[model samples]
Target: MSRTPPGTRADYAAFTPITTRWADNDAYGHINNVQYYSFFDTAVNAWLVRQGLLDITASAEIGLVVETGCRYHRPIAYPDPIEVGMRLASLGNSSIRYELAVFAPGNDTAAAEGHFVHVYVDRATGRPSRLPDALRAAAESLRAPGSGSA
Candidate 1:
């Protein structure tokens, strides 16, 4: 509902570079709205993997995205390099909310911004579980000091 982008540099403590693909553009001649979500997902999970917090294949505790929303301010097309800025808003007993911003090359403002809530669950039971200490620690490191927000 905000004209201004939601996630910004102050909100993200880490960054991941992304390259737009030729196929990512839609008939509208810009990156499709849905593709932004994919980029959002990829950036967050890639961070989790890089930090050794998420085990996509074998961990008993796995995160399932329960909610996501995005706001697009401008179009991002192929052939341009981008950076996805990311941070952890909070770590609940069983869930974590990640703030994300997609920035085009050389742009200080974001093209799209979003947040995703991932609920950790037991793989076999599909029941919510307390976030692992390691996972929580990893997520906390990505949060900007004194900047956790809703």
Candidate 2:
């Protein structure tokens, strides 16, 4: 099987810094693989919040994660100051795919790279919903060159 190459910081359009908790480490003395997904989620949602596109308590439209996958280039341990870089890989009527990279402090290349897919849904009905204009614009701001509609 071929491996996907790690992404560089320039490949992303937005960035969010994340602190690794001591508890995030596992018996292997590194951040557990599962924790990378948490980082991805945090980075994306935090960006949404910053853009005023999401209101956890009252937004009528919410995004439900539909898919996620990661590729690890190296293990990162607790206390490592890291940053998650994000960019829109594609956007659809009801879904968006975000490409993310985890970088150690001062690094230009990623230690891990991942993709996360979220399907926008009606908060009350839990059914798929079209992306709101504001949300679409915010998402578009994170699109790297060459990324577009899904």
TM-score of each: 0.91, 0.94
Report every candidate's CA lDDT. Answer: 0.85, 0.92
Mark the regions of model 2 whose C-alpha exceeds 4 Å error after superposition. 145-150
Give lDDT: candidate 1, residue 14: 89
lDDT of 1 by residue, 16-62 (tens): 99889989999988998998889889998899889887778888899
| Model 1 bad stretches (over 4 Å) | 5-7, 145-150
* Candidate 2, residue 83: how far the Cα is off, in Å: 0.3
- Name the candidate that leads on TM-score: 2
Candidate number of the best lDDT = 2
